[model samples]
Every structure is written in structure tokens, then in C-alpha cells.
Target: MKFALVDDIKTEAVKGAKGICPSCGSEMIARCGNFKINHWAHKGRRKCDPWWENETIWHRSWKNNYPIEWQEISLLDEKTGEKHIADIQANDGLVIEFQHSYINPEERFSREKFYKKMVWVVDGTRLKKDYPRFMKGKSDFITTNKPGIFKVDFPDECFPYAWLESSVPVVFDFGKLFESISGISNPMYCLFPKHENYYALIAEINRKTFIKTTLNGEWLSRTEEFLKQSKKTKLNRTFIQPIENTIRRKPSKYVLERGKWKKRRRF
Candidate 1:
């Protein structure tokens, strides 16, 4: 797919606008630009650092192929002065965020202060490598073929998107995420915007057993319990390790049998 921003914001305006900075509500915001990417910048040093670095990374990776629509936002909580500008818009009035680096715990808690439905997408693989590098044998992290999608309903008190700022790594196993949504027939498929095929499989799995198989490229074995077990968690979430010695096989064609030459001679 061709990548470009879906919003009306032009390439030039995407860098900076006169509007107040979403993080601090400062009117000193300005636009910055480069050949490949563009985003807002503060005119002077401000309190909250813009998440431009994080946004740049994702833009470089998928911007040319999958442009994201960035909406200007400045959400505030009446109780605290904390604020957040979500990364993207979810189909059903939900907010979506893509985080790459570690975030402050306080910052995390404040993100979901106002929203009812919010989704946070972080680099699960990076988290695994940072924390659980040495302790491999204990939990036995079973890597699935695809990155798992998780839909965790937050406790009313806890901010749902707050986990994005947790210093501890958050992990997700692809198999586990699929299993969670398998039971619900025709569950909403907006959680993972990157994986379109998964949405179709999820619908099929919910309707009948053994109908839809595999995601990305990994073939799934038939087991309802196993499907349920796959999930993205705060522990060992990462892409599944590829099996090195797996023998590659090709499909074979059947051939018709021929009678011995002796029968033809007798005739």
C-alpha cells in the first residue's frame, strides 16, 4: 500500500502549526521539516518533550507504505494537569498510541484519565530483549509466529493507556491474543490496524472450528485451549523464533497406474 498521511494536514504544516502544543498547551510551537518526515517543534525549551523521536521512527518504517492520519489534540484532566496527544484514531471513537521507548510511570497513568476506550501499541520485542535477556529457562517464552494483539479493559481507577509508560517491558504472544478473541463471533477488528488478514481469520475462527489457520506466515495447529493460551503480556512478548531445521516440503501430484507390457502382447 502507498504510504502517506490520511489527514488533510499538508507535508509542510505537518511539521509545525501555530496551535498550542498538545503536551503543554504552549503557544510557542513551530513546524519543522525534513526530506522524509515532518512534525511539530516547540519555539523554546518547554517542560514536556514532544514525542517526535518516537513518531519519526514509525514514520520511517511504514510512512512510505502506510501513511497515518495525525490529528491535532490537546486533552486535559480536571483532577491533574497531565496531558496526552494520541498517535492515531480508532474506528469507534477510541484512541490509539504507538510507543517505542520507555515512558515515565506518572506520564502513563495520566494518558487515560479522560478516555474510555484507548489502545496502546508498543514495541513488544524490544521490551523482551531489555529485561528478560538472561532469564530464558524459567518461564520458557514460547514465541509465536506473529506479534500478539491484546485488548485489556482497564480498571476504572487505572488508566488503560498508562501501561505505555511503564519502565518494565510489556510482552505479547501472538497465539495468546488470537485465542482471547476466538470465542467472540465477529468481534471488532480494530485493535491491530497493521494486520488486516488477522481480522478476517478472527471472524472465521469464531464462527467455526478449523476454518481459518495461520497468520502472517505461521500455520496454527488445531487446539482451542492452545489458541486461548497465546497472548501479549507484560512478561515475554516477542516475535516467535524461526525453527532453523524445519524441512521445507512441496505438494505432490498423483499419477495413474499402467498395466504391464505382457497384457498388450497377449492382445
Candidate 2:
């Protein structure tokens, strides 16, 4: 499977995950949705930590929970003939970078012009926050009155993206790490894939490992099998109405290989 390491995971991905800087131990961290993975940005004192700007809430958490060796990398900014430090680097060909700086013309075009197996976490602050700098027409989860409301304004040109509840952009390989949701440890994973401004109903799995089989449409029958082995199901849910609606709209598109509980609808 192809994996892309991002400097930040989408805020939506962290909606219930947790909120704290991975490095300097700060609470003023924010996450936005990027192509498929989420992007994180730090907003606080600049001098307290050197790695704060490069680390997001999830990144910090990942480091604490699982300390993996990362290498320092340098990449040339094509727009400006200068070199910048890559956010996080793996021994393999994985390079993670986060762009929290205010987006200027050069910065915007700089990302577009660069060609590497890189992940970009764009800002959706206008959609997620109440700052004076927020852009018009951006969605905000805080302002929206609806429950289970997560919105992120994504640029159409971006690839493999998901809109998080914080109205932050999250981009990733939709087919790869998405399965990770089903394996979450404590917090139940509830995923709602919102595309084209359409949202599916809430659906969840107790743990991340379950996502792989569930994604294959085995939730109903496999629910029992998963329950017997699940460590945390007290509050676990992930849903996508479009997929269900798709199957309902066209039953021929899906093949039910499990059992006769086909007519049972939980939502």
C-alpha cells in the first residue's frame, strides 16, 4: 500500500482523537483537512518550541505513543532558490511537511510547482475558526447549530481530500490509511465522508482494525464477530450515507456476501 506521511493529520481526524501539540505540549493547536490526510497548524508563542510549527496535535501524539525514528531532511523551495527543512522524514521515501504560514502568492504557487511524493495540509481556518482573518463563505463547526456537523471547504483541484468537522481540509490516499480509522484504540472512530457538499449519516466502528472488513461491507454480519473481540465499543461509530444511499439507489452495485440481515437498517 502507498502511504504518505503528513506533518499534520486533518482536524476532522482529530475531532474526537485528542487536541495537544505533539512536541512542545501546547493546547493552542489546530488541524485542517488536506487531500486525504489532515494538516495541523500551531498557534501560540513562537519561542517556546522550535518544532512546534512543524508538529501538529496528532503528530505529537503519535510520537508520544509510538516513538519512531525520523530523519531530518531538506528540500529546495522552487519559488525561492532557498532550502527549507522537511517536517518529518522516514528512512524510506516518505517526506512530511506542513505549511502553517500565511499563504501568499509565492507560497501558494510554491506547493503547486513542487513535484515529490509529498503531502500538503491546507488551511480552512475561514471555515473552522472565528478569527477576524477568516475568509467569507467558509463553514465553521462552532457556528453551525447542527450536531454531528463537520465541514471543510476543499479546493476542487486538490486530490484525495476529506472535510473535517473543524472545517479543516484533510487529504490522503482514500484507499490506504482510511482503514486506520477502524483501528482506533480509545476513541470510537466515526467517519462521515462528505464530498460535493453531501454527507452520509453517522456510522462508526469500535476500533480501527474493523474498518478494513467493514469497508468491504461486512458490518452487519460481522458485527457479532467484531463485538466478541472488540476492546472498546462503548462509543464507537463511523458512518457514510453516500455509500449506503448508493447501494440503495442501485442495489446492483453492491454484493451482499454476509447474511440475510440485509433489510435491517440501524440508522
Candidate 3:
């Protein structure tokens, strides 16, 4: 993790410094290597939390965006007395998790349930094909009357399926911030899951705007306004065509089999 308790005080890892794990209170050693970012590690190479993953440069960069106190906070469950360290616990009780690796749906759901109000900042650049796959799925979005909100038919195939049914909001970090076809700047795509529909809210703001709006719980309101404006204005169709590729593909094998069975039973 980025910070450890040194003499009961949260401290960043420095060469030759010793610390303690914030969660388990175990002895931790600072690892300052040339290849990797400086970070604290358990002395015996053991992990206190099963959910903890090795910190990467990407993870560190995200943590650096917030204050040091907000990073790696230990949260307690009032009823169960269980504790888990959050990636970032904002002042408003919002947990921002920087996810680099893929975890099962169960774990993802468990984290969300424990945090209650949380958001995921997933690394879209983790895999080479992630962007292409996401773009393919985005192409099939069903426009909604709610402006920035949208309804996706097969989100399981288009999104990181683990977050498809997430109870809270999720923002996908597509590596770089650029101007969209609509002439709006965006740093990430926000996916808000409601019942059976996955609504994709394109963020028309830069990275700082995203951070600030999210912390203040104003992103949803901004999204609505952006969508309203989008409806009134005309976007560049040529630029939209790339991301809106319209080659309708066949359904999955399971879907095909289910359709066939339904047809046979009807006859």
C-alpha cells in the first residue's frame, strides 16, 4: 500500500524506513527499489488483508490526487466490528477505489456492500483490448430520454461485466482525456447501473473536474445538463462513426440455444 503507520503516524515509504501495517498492525518494511515505486510491505511477505493487491504506479498516481489523509483509510463496520482499508475515503464518506486488476463479481459486490457509498475508478489501459471491446459495446447503446443517461442491452458483453450490475456508480478511465465528437472534453466515462439498464454518462469535463464533481456529488447533475445541451446541438457524425461502429454481430451461444429451445417448444 502507499502509506503505513510509522510510530502510529501515517507515513509514506522511504528508503531504510520501518513501519507498521495500518490494518493488521504488523511489522512492515519500506521497499524502495529503482524499478518499482517506493511502498511499504509486510516484513514476512504476508498480507493482512486478502483483498489487498500489490500497488502499481497507476494506483499510486490516483492516490496522489487526493490528500494523504484520504488515502488508505481503515474503516470499521459498526455492527460486525470488521475492518477493511479503503483506497480513498473522502471527507463525505465516499470511497473511491482504484482498481487495476480484475476481481470476481462476489468480491466486487462485497466491497460495494461494505462501503455503502462507493465509486470505482478502473484502469481501462490495464489490458490492450479493453478499449476496443468497450467501444464495440458502446456502439450498441440505446439512447434514453434522460439525456446523458442511456440503456444498454448486453452490458455483460460490452463492459467489465463485474461492474455491470454494481449498485453504485462506476467511472471507466480510458487512459487519456480528449475532446469527444460532440466537442466536449472528457477524462472518463461514467456508468450508472439502474435496475436492468446500464446508463453511460459521458463526462464532458477534464480530470480535475471529474475529481471535484465526484467529491461534491455534483457529477450526476452536470451529466444531465451536458446531455440536454447535446440534444440541442449537432455533433460531428464523422467523428461519432468510429466509436459507433454498426456491424451487428450474432448473439452468444447460450442466447442462441435458448431461442432455439423456445421456438421448438412453441411448435
Global lDDT of each model? 0.34, 0.32, 0.69
Best-matching candidate per lDDT: 3
Collision count for each candidate, in order? 17, 36, 0
- Which candidate tops TM-score? 3
Per-prediction TM-score, please? 0.39, 0.29, 0.78
lDDT of 1 by residue, 1-267 (tens): 011122333223343345444455454434454553444445565545344343555534423322244333445556776555555433344454555666775655455444544544444334444224212211222334443333221111112133423322222212222223225532222222121211111111231221122111111223223334432223233653422333323221211123101111222
Point out the worst 10-residue segment of candidate 1 by lDDT.
195-204
Q: After superposition, how far is residue 85 of candidate 2 from its true place, in Å?
A: 0.6
What is the alpha-carbon lDDT for the whole of candidate 2? 0.32
Higher-ranked by TM-score: 1 or 3: 3
Between candidates 1 and 3, name the one with more favorable lDDT: 3
Cα RMSD (angstroms) for every candidate in the order listed: 20.4, 17.6, 6.2
Q: Give a tens-digit lDDT track for model 2, residues 115-231.
A: 244334333232323222222212221112223322322211121112232111122211222222224333222323222222221222333443233234444344334333332
lDDT of 3: 0.69
Question: In model 1, what lDDT does residue 17 have?
Answer: 46
In the range 1-267, model 3's lDDT, one tens digit per residue, is 888888789999999999989888888999999999898999987987777888898898888888888889888998998788899888777788889998898899899899987888888767777888877666776544433344454554556656665666778887663344334456566775443312233332356777887667675465456555655753333333233657777653222131121112322
